[model samples]
Target: MKRSEQNVVARSSLPWNHSCGSKSFAATMSTKAEIPHFVDFFKESHWSKKKDDWLDHKCMEKHGELENLRTMCSQPDAIPMSQEEMSVAVLGKKSGYLRGYGVGRKPCNTNTTSRDNGEEVIILREELSSLKELNDTQQQQLEAQNEQLAIQQQQIKAQNQKLEKFQEVLLRCGLLSSDECGEESTEGG
Candidate 1:
């Protein structure tokens, strides 16, 4: 046999190519049909098309849900959603975005077990500090509101006292009857 034929025979004799069989191998060598690489072949095959279609359907479904959420938000009576809640709704629970991970930080691949524990502790401490800061801010705002409310109450009391004195003067001048004054006071209260 010629060298090229000999090479073909040797190649076809390999364990993986045994499925071709001798006659089919000869026919394959004679045929003009190209043998595709596995990856390229799979790319054009049914399974690949099925997978792509499935993925596209999932993306469309998610897009539709997001559109609905946007529409709901545009409505006047819609409750406001926080960024974290929106992200969790759009992305699944397992997404790292909700946990504030994988952005400008290295993956936790420490050699020592203690190092991992230390990193976790640091993260917890940071979260705790942030929560404490929020609590302090809310407390300060509540105190301010309370102070304003107390001042308002005092002003209202002063206005009521002035109204009472004016009513007494009206009574002395016979402008308003005592029954009318009493009724006005009751209504105001």
Candidate 2:
């Protein structure tokens, strides 16, 4: 065989096949592993656009019901409840349901808590602190802007008063009376 044809055969017979196959499989398995267990909870059910519409309808109904409950509770005759009782009534005993399904769980404490799979808790306290600082800065800016607006209003009021005084002086001096001023100047001349 020619040198080019021999090179092609050598390349085709390389161990790249085994390495590539294993790497691809490992990548696929890792991706699948990252999916939350809650996704499988609804897998058996047919997920269609209609299901999403139904969920939206249910959410609206629940919101309306909560609003009605709030109005009722605000009445003078309504019974008062403690915070714990209110929480129990609103959230029920299934508070850990999300954690059970591996969805929306609170971030694990880096200092003490440990996940079964040994994943490190991603600490974002520094990021959160920076965000809070940004919010405070924004609030300060808004307050400063309000104070500046008030100062501008006072300045505008002062300017208006000064303009009124100037007009009054002009009127008192008879300078505002064009015809009278003209006739007086003509008689003097």
Candidate 3:
């Protein structure tokens, strides 16, 4: 069989092979400017933008084959893109492609601002909890300090009462002479 006929047959039979088969064909057709219809068909297919890295690799490999075919056919100007250009284009387009059909979900209106707001809420909750804990600790310390102050005040009151009784005894025993007591009273006054 001719090489071209063999390639066509192989491509046709690929539907029964595996999921990677369609991707491989798409990649193979990507380099051929002469086969724009096939290229468009592959690009528009739902399976083209799947998240399967193995399939992507196989597709890339088949694209290399298309380049080889172009080289063999001596149609240098028919090349779709230079290696550098293709790489840049592929990288640039991949994000959009994945976001569109590759992710298999409807694109929502979520943005970076919403994500930042979520993080801010979490931070604020943590800060509030910490402040509450600090306030509780301060209240406990204040209670402890107030208890200590009460104990000290009771000690001072007892000491004052003892001093007053000792002074009365001294005066009653006459240990302080009248003149001395008189002087003491004057000093006390």
Best prediction by lDDT: 1
Q: What local distance difference test score does each model get?
A: 0.58, 0.48, 0.53
Write candidate 1's Cα lDDT for 23-115 as tens digits: 442243335378542222212221234345422344445445555665676689998554334435764455343311112212442244368
Clashing pairs in 1: none
Q: Could you arrange the candidates by TM-score from highest to lowest?
A: 1, 3, 2
The alpha-carbon deviation from the true structure for residue 2 of candidate 3, after best TM-score superposition, in angstroms, is 61
Q: How are the candidates ranked when ordered by lDDT, highest leading?
A: 1, 3, 2
TM per candidate comes to 0.42, 0.32, 0.37
- Poorest lDDT segment (10 consecutive residues) of candidate 2: 37-46
lDDT of 3 by residue, 90-121 (tens): 32344333211223212342444467579879
lDDT of 2 by residue, 1-189 (tens): 999999899867642222222333324334663632221222211123545532334334433444455566668999744322332344343454331122233355322336522432234666678889999999999999999999999998887677666656777887677565555446643
108: Cα error in model 1, Å:
13
Q: Judged by TM-score, which candidate is best? A: 1
Q: What ranges in model 2 sit over 4 Å off?
A: 1-122, 177-189
